[model samples]
Target: MNTETTNTERSTQIMHTEKQIEFDKIKNIWKNLAITDYAKECIQNTEICLDEVELRNRLRDTTNSKEMIEKLGTPPFQNITEIRDIMAIGQKGDCLTPYQLERVERVLVVVERLRDYLSRGKQFYNSLAYYDENLDALPELREEINMKIRNDGVDDRATDRLFDIRSKMISVEESMKQKAEQTIRNNKECMADTYYTLRNGRVCVPVKKDYRYKIQGSVIDKSSTGSTYFVEPAGVAKQYEELALLKIEEENEVYNILYTLTAMVIYAIPVMEENMRMIEKLDFIFSKGKLSVDLDCVEPQINLERKIELTKARHPLMDKSISVPLDFKIGETERGIVITGPNTGGKTVAIKTVMLNAYMAQCGLHVSCKAANISMNSNYLCDIGDGQNISENLSTYSAHIKNVLEILKEVNKDSFVIMDELGSGTDPAEGMGIATAILEELRKSNANFLVTTHYPEVKEYADKTEGIINARMTFDKETLKPTYRMVIGEAGESCAFYIADRLGMPKEMLENAVTAAYGKGAISNYKFKNDNLKKKEVKNVIIKKRKYHKDTKLSTLYTIGDSVMVFPDKKIGIVCEPVNEKGVLRVQVADKKIYINHKRVKLLVKSEELYPEDYDFSIVFDSVENRKIKHDLDRKYTDEVYHYDIEK
Candidate 1:
């Protein structure tokens, strides 16, 4: 085959394989971290938690729901279907609605109430509780006593005694009120001056003028502002008065309230936190649930368990019923499996089945296997098939060489590698030589590999190497369809003549070609079968698989609004429409939607993909919104399809 033809075939195979592992439910084991019952219920119901308010508050407070969970513990609130549902009735965006804003105000009100109750618990003897103005009437009391004496209510000696007593009363009252006022003022200032800012090269209160003097002492500079006052320096008398009120008994009451409220709010942290974590998981599940695929007769597995076992798998890209699964195995002694069969004998599909499934499994996706027991090393390398990138100024030969080199770099004694056709871009002698050398290297490396080749050199290697083996996709010449089945230890027999006859090739032309090919030794170059493998047989097998899928009825056929499952894995996707005439169901996952055939759709079985083995999950406490950048390719490349930045 020409290099161009080979490249095209390879690219087609790879594209198909990639499509097989649908991207949306492409195996995210991270989701299992949410192991709590609340999380499981949410996923199972395909319902999101409405815990937006809790999360919003945590975010506003520069905290996360998960953080609180570590300190305080789990939440107490029962799961609400939607925390944001009520808000949903409101408009969305950065701004809040009247009702939403009211909620915020209520939060602030609660804070104020808490502060009030704390203040009321203060003790009479507590320095912080003393009222200063009431304590400053000593002088006035003494004056009143003197005035009474002047009114001639008593003798001169009596008046002197009364005046002395009044003087003493005035002195004591002034001391009490002065000290109480100073302590109260200090507390008020502490609350008021909680925040500050820098302005015009001065450290100033970050409040309005009215609040400034109370919060931060009035500035003494006269040049300061239109509204300015000087606060008298607090003195020793004021300090003594504050000290007199410092009784532990009195202070304890106020501390008790502070401690109680803090404990109450802090205690609710875990529950609130749990709800928030659930909401995040819900968002992810819902977002991912949008894409859906179908599963049917495709059961392809890896031979890690001495025998390969795969069941009910589907092509990720093809409409549901069209994907067929083939089950077979190659042994350890067989280092390489060479698959060959007639044209359209599902040679490509079988090759893709092995390669793509391996890729998906490594990437963490659940495979389309009912029982999958794949034992594979970490490194997965593939040169399945790719068309040459003409735009890259590389020809088929060059692209193949590059791909081979890339694969070789990663291949090791234990690596699993799949190569479609080793070398086919040049002359037959040179091509066979290159293919033979490559096979020799792979065999020597003792790596587990699979390759599809029409070259004699590859077949020869399979015959000679102890660990190498040959497998062929069976083509019943009587049935025109490639049976899509596999057979081990057999060299594939080409049915070219049979195919030509079935397709109604001209008798004279067929005869002439056969003679020419035989004379060229092409007929004897490899095995060829001349028989009738009717198309009807191929069609029947496909129909049978489809019927099996249909008869295996999922509990419900998804409708426009119903939630559905995307497969090869179970993911929540919303059904956008019922099955169309072609048996294809359309669904949306996230922002993307595509039509899938019915065979792949199944009633959501268990809600989760059970983990493979011992797994540890860490709780994630943050949310990140998806970032999408729309690229206008046409606009970006106005002059060319491919642009290279030589200058850069």
Candidate 2:
């Protein structure tokens, strides 16, 4: 295989397939099982591996870890995941703080323990013991660090120079105390206290404020109340200065000791860093084992041939009790399966389970199944879910179309693809056409895939195609619920009519719906029965009429009798019609009834305020001759009425 091409394809697959299969969720599970931050980071950056030897090696290590834990108990893997920065500090020529050095010591201790643990069972765990060869014990550095450092500070015996400096400072401090005692006794009457105390790193005797000037010493610090002063005895003043010098020397020696230890650590930085990496790798390996035990997983039989056969496979995220176990296969005879089922019938879950299992197995983790005979693929591409991009103003169907187009561009025989609800979220006729054409194109690509659809025509195409098979999520008509079982070599009913019938929809309407779906004669041939159970059956019942309170009052001034001015025409006319749903209105403009939009007509006057109650608008709207013809028609029959209507 071309390395560049294979890497490019895997990158694309990781970009698109993670969220669709919730692979990150599985990673979170792995992360939680890990004892070290190193392992967690390793898990986060893991790629879906397809290399046969590399994948087998990782799985073998994981299996070894699982057995090692079962027989020998948990390996003493410390949570010293923060060793990277500690090593970086030493490598950058900075002295490691006592705390940070202890962390490095911790890493070394864990390495030693793991080696010993694996060695004790070397006869039984030869593979596990193989890591001991590359691992350098680095006993000199470990022992030096352990001896020189404490939890909080460097030990006094860390260096001979530091030890001598501290010893001389102690002797000088004792001599200063003896001299201060003599001065306090000679000036007992002037002393504020009998004991000598420390003041500015010098032994001092507290004196009364009035007698501070009389004391044979220099005042260093005074009490807050100003009644007493801390004075250094003049005899010990020179000795205090000498002890201070020794203290400075002590600091320099301590730094020298720390620097020497850090130099040794820096020399071994390369080894320790490599050791840290190995420890992290071992942590990740054991974590995979822990996840295997938690998920009750089995090693999948990875094959070079692109065939998938899984038995009793459950989605790793779902509860096993509630989730239906899937037995699915492809690439043996059929290259693709067209799944047809009603809504929420596990069609989506069915495909997702198969895809996620194949993904996990390829990554060298045990799959959650009794048996997973899987194949390695260059990439697994799926265009599942709505993924509606609201910010970009893309609809569900538009998103699906975009994703499917992108998937189609990168599909191949080594590619495992899954598409759900193909040709949905659009006009049925056009969507079905686009779906069929896309399927044919996919067939040409020879990619092993699974497609779910509600289009009956797609089902027919699957039945006739040689490399395609028809599958369905079984539904129970009697219970009006889905069984959530996948059956091969059969097509499924949408069960819309049965569900509607059970929901109290009239039988005639369901029959009409069937007719509309499959055309006129399909209703008689449709297989469904009306539930006659009186308690559960739908019954015709009279509904009570209601008038809800209206919240919005009309603001428009167009009334039947109101005078309105027509725009551009500038003719005054009585409003003869109310605004319709289209906002069109009728206005009698001088016996020529004009049809115009409401926007063109404006209210000129209020009829209720001007016209009297029960007023006859004929005086304002009709001519005298036309009124006489209307009065004649109301009292007696006449052909003159036709002339009146035609003239009006």
lDDT of 2 by residue, 479-583 (tens): 877888899889988787888877776665666556434545576776656645344344432222222246522334366787666764557788766777676
TM-score between candidate 2 and the true structure? 0.75
| Residue 67 in candidate 1, Cα distance off native in Å | 31
Tell me the tens digit of each residue's lDDT in model 1 across 565-594: 565344556565577666777666555666
Q: Which residue runs of candidate 1 sit more than 4 Å off their true CA positions?
A: 1-274, 278-308, 311-320, 362-364, 503-648
lDDT value, residue 554 of candidate 2? 35
Give TM-scores for every candidate, taking all chains together and pairing residue i with residue i: 0.40, 0.75
Best by lDDT: 2
Question: Candidate 1: lDDT over CA atoms?
Answer: 0.46
Candidate 2's error at 609, in angstroms?
55
